[model samples]
Target: MSVTVCLGSQFGDEGKGKLVDILANNANLCCRAQGGNNAGHTIVANGKTFDFHILPSGLINPKCINLVGSGCVVHVPSFFKELEALEKHGLNTTERIFISDRAHVVFDLHQLVDGLEEAELANSFIGTTRKGIGPTYSTKMTRSGVRIADIFDPEIFESKLRRLAHGFQRRFGELLKYDLEAEISRYKNYREKLVPYVIDQIPMLNSAKEQKMDILVEGANAIMLDIDYGTYPFVTSSNTGLGGVLTGLNLGWRSIKEVIGVVKAYTTRVGSGPFPSEQLNEIGDKLQGVGQEVGVTTGRKRRCGWLDLVIIKYSHDVNDYTSLNLTKLDVLDDFEEIKVATGYSFQGQKLESFPANPETLAKVDVTYETLPGWKIPTTGAKYFYDLPVNARKYVEFIEKAVGVKIRWIGVGPGRENMISR
Candidate 1:
């Protein structure tokens, strides 16, 4: 079983798409395990760019079959929209793409409740994509969700929509009443487009495993957004970590032999959460500006900070990460000095182990280890040794800090920019 899994190591936007696109060329299949259209992965190829929300980045690879597995909460409209865009750009879903029949559908009520609930939170919204992700998962937890197969059942579809709308109406009536009738009309129209691609993904996925085809499990959000492992109340509803794969794909953890955690050269987080190593300074401003770090899904400015080795190691320790792919090394070209948070000082006491308690996590103070910046353009570097000495040193520091082998480094924006060490 040649299986590989890729996930975000930080708060996300870790350039996972580019790396996935690169690795997808060698793999026969790519499976998206969790989350929904709330996250975006930007992949550039053939001098054109593709922004993926539902489709795996590997969908752009002609030889790789992309599967949306049972764990994902899909926005059918967004999935079709992205498909249209990819097809318009010469990449079609073809017969290789599969959508799990077990996957929950992001219905109109999901969107209405997602947006309306955030509006209700006002000061405390969890910074969701408002693309109906939270609501889709909510329906699944409550066992009232519509699935990919539900689209074909007209009566069941109508009935579920009515039930879900009523649930939302009670929660959001005074806040933002949903246009239930209009939503029904819109989704009835949407079902026409989704019918061709929506499918029972589990059988196809497991069959591929039986045939020993190269299957990859791709995650939607970063590890920091994982519901159980991440910062609670501020976390994404689904699991972004590796454990989600076991449930999302209905596969045991032992089936996955390689787990590649994608970490950015520096740190960037989107939405609101506890960032233990966030840099609130002139350097932070420069980091954000230089990287043009913004949420592709929500268009919100990303929270920039120093690379947190504490979290990187914690990520590996939690997931049993086998290797690391450091992305956005080119973004460090403009920085004068590079900083990596190697330790944390909590309440005047130093700590090495990852905080098991939420209270301890909230109180931990991050401490840094700085390195001399290379300040040289590295967009064209083809090999690890080709990198400048300072860049190599920074890589070494990270390898030492995280104790994971540095396998590849993403030097630029495109799929081709990735280099193996």
Candidate 2:
């Protein structure tokens, strides 16, 4: 009857897929709560590397059922593409995956609008993945978006889609270019292929709850990218925190037994934002090259920096993580020293929490605490005690600061590289 929620505590790319894949083995069901194909998770299991965009990572577990909840926005083409890739990998996907009927669809028109919007912003663009995620959510919030259920009713779907396109045309004028008719024609074929996967999640979840099935909710993006709690204008369109789990899944707070926050040993952020502890020197380059700090979705090089406990603590305040999963610790093995941002100071005065204003955040001076690096490889460590003394102290420092245990430690990219405490 246990329900566990796993989330990224930093600015995403925290290896959540690997953690979810490991945890899914004992679960009956795994659900994706929010985001669209704009989010990505790379999982290595059974000697196969899977890059999941619109699908659940639980598909790695043969016995686990996967669901895409109403809070998610689906890109139909990408969904089928991912499914086909999975099927080609010899995984049986039939009757094992489902999507909520209430989920909104991401149309090609929306993707075009996303590009137009970003181009208009120019240098100050929000650095989106241009997958129509923001545009879809924008239409959704305005009540002009089409849902999964609409596709079955061709007449109604066509009318709504045309109107939605017209609104975008009115907003962007000649800058917006799309073939509405071609997209509609494509959906005609997609509708039949999608019928079996669409479902009313309420009863399905209710049945899981009544039967006391072990449920796992996989959160896309990270708390620092949350629309409400993250750095504004630089943040994603949806809630990426605990609040999303409730709104996205229609699950009660009491049902959740554990909330795990996935934190990378070093901080890395893709796109633009105020990063107080970013190291632009050789250290940054080393971390980037060694850790492969490139975004899974955007393919952009991630800005690397020391561990930012200020960000982690703020994320904890919002998510109330029951435990933490420290990932990519081996990425720091070769460094002579390791640093962590402990707090932020604005104009010589310390700020108690994460700044709401991006301007203030950009200007705040970071206070760092330096620690000795382990200097030894942790990739072969099979247990917590197997790690070097300095490595153990580094993990313990984060635990003591956040007041949460590091339940799991990821030493490398593979599932076998993880150490459970």
In order of appearance, the predictions have TM-scores of 0.95, 0.99
Candidate 1 residues lying further than 4 Å off, grouped into runs, are 356-363
lDDT of 1 by residue, 245-321 (tens): 87888656667889999999889888766787788888888879988898889899898988988888888978888
Please give the lDDT score for candidate 2.
0.94
- Which residue pairs collide in model 2, if any? none
RMSD of each: 1.7, 0.7
Q: Which candidate is the best by TM-score?
A: 2
- lDDT leader: 2
